[model samples]
Target: MSLVRLSIKGISYSQTQNGAYALILNEVDGERKLPIVIGAFEAQSIAIALEKEIRPPRPLTHDLFKTFADRFDIVVKQVIIHKLVDGVFYSSMICERDKIEEIIDARTSDAIALALRFDAPIFTYKNILDKAGIYLNMSSEDKSDSEESDDILSTPETFGNTSSDEEIKNTYAKYTLAELNDLMDQAVQDEDYEKAAKIRDEITKRES
Candidate 1:
């Protein structure tokens, strides 16, 4: 199957599932976005990587992996979202050392997080895209095209959270958007992605 490159678009709380976030991946050369429900930790890790301005005082797991890889002269070449099965994505990390390459199994979220740290491209197979990808309508003339398309399109399948131990409470609705924004920022700073997801979900619910 041919490979289609993808880029990180944004992260938002998954409305269908509590304590999960949608990691939106835009087709590199198309309008479709692949939204995969990932855990809060991966969501925050990906968000921090994308922000480029927020740095944790200590290393995150992904950060430590990056530093360790660099010290050993092992470099990540790219990440591939190789398979989608029963609403789950399987990814692999392509790493190189001493001119030899290796493919390592990884969670799609972890692969993406490390890909960002290493400036690696992300890809998925065309067949997989054909099966699971969601197309969103857009137009340069309509600024509200996004909101309109969201309403017009069929909702893509959403995966559920693995556990309820960290489920986000709905208390966020009592807070204003501004308050949620502050809370989200603080959550990101404190690496509290469950709180961040809850705040984000409330903000998105109000916006929609």
Candidate 2:
């Protein structure tokens, strides 16, 4: 099977699952997005990794892994979402040390979190993308921020029901963009990444 490169699109709160989030991966050369449902802790870790400006007072689990790897010279070269079974995606970390490479099994969420810290590439087989990828009705890049946020927050049927954009909009409707931004920054500083993500979403929803 041919490999398809993917990039992190963004993460969204899962409307149907309590304490869950949707980790969206975009096909680098295509319009389809692969949405993987992840637990809240994994989501928080991944979100923290993406927020370059937010540094936790202490290392998260994934951060500890990176520190340990660096201490021994084990480097994460890349991550591959190599398999999917019953809606669960399987991944492997391509690690290198002492001129030798090893493939280590990992959960998709953990692998991705590590990928961000290592600045490693992520890829999945074409078959997996074809089977589970979601295609938004409209082009997200060309849409206005309001439109793009709506397009992104609409969960794929396989993932579960999505909250209406208006519902999410109303949750933070009273906050101005500046206020929302401040709230997000405070949430991050407090290590409340889930809250930070929600606030961030609202900020995106209103940004022009």
Candidate 3:
């Protein structure tokens, strides 16, 4: 299987699945996109990594991993989203330490997050992309913040894409950082990482 380079197109909340978010990846040389469903905590971690200006008061799990990897001289050379089974995407981190390289299994979300922090490239198998990739009617790069908040992406029949109206219409903008943190804790306790991610986005927006 040949590898295709990919870049983060955007992240959007899943209207069809509560607490699920879509991590959109675009092929660097093609219009095909791979949208992987991920948990809210992973979404928040990825978004935080992308937003170079927004620093969290504490390190997130991905951040901690990045710090530890850096300290030990384990550099992530690249991340590969290699498989899709039952709608779940599997990824591997291609890391090197002491002039030796190894591949480590990881959730697609976490792999991408660390890739961003390490400035490592991301890739996916061409066969996998051909299986799950779709050509959106609209460009992923053109999606606005409001559109992301709203749910407007579609994948053609070849790809299995969920469909539904946008859920959780409330904007967390009105909540203060402390309130958002409390809500984040509650969301975690309730295992509602999606809501926690939305709150995290709102907090990041305020800081930006």
Q: Give candidate 2's TM-score.
A: 0.70
- Of 1 and 2, the candidate ranking higher by lDDT: 2
Model 1 TM-score, all chains together: 0.70
Query: Which residue runs of candidate 2 sit more than 4 Å off their true CA positions?
Result: 139-208
TM-scores for candidates 1 onward, in order: 0.70, 0.70, 0.67
List the candidates ranked by lDDT, beginning with the highest.
2, 1, 3
Ten-residue segment with the worst summed lDDT in candidate 2? 152-161
Q: Which ten residues in a row have the lowest lDDT in candidate 3?
A: 151-160
> Candidate 2's residue-wise lDDT over 82-179, tens digit each?
98654457899999999999999988889999999999999999988876665444435544552354322222222222345576678788888888
Task: Please give the CA lDDT of all the candidate structures.
Answer: 0.71, 0.73, 0.69
Q: Go through the candidates in order and give the clash count of each.
A: 0, 0, 0
- By TM-score rank, best first, the candidates go 2, 1, 3
Best by lDDT: 2
**Per-residue accuracy of model 1 over 1-208 as CA lDDT, tens digit each:** 8999999767767555676776777798987656677877888888888878889999999999999999999999999988865446789999999999999999888999999999999999998777656545435655254434332010222322332322433455467778877876675444333344445544544774
Model 2 CA lDDT for position 105: 93
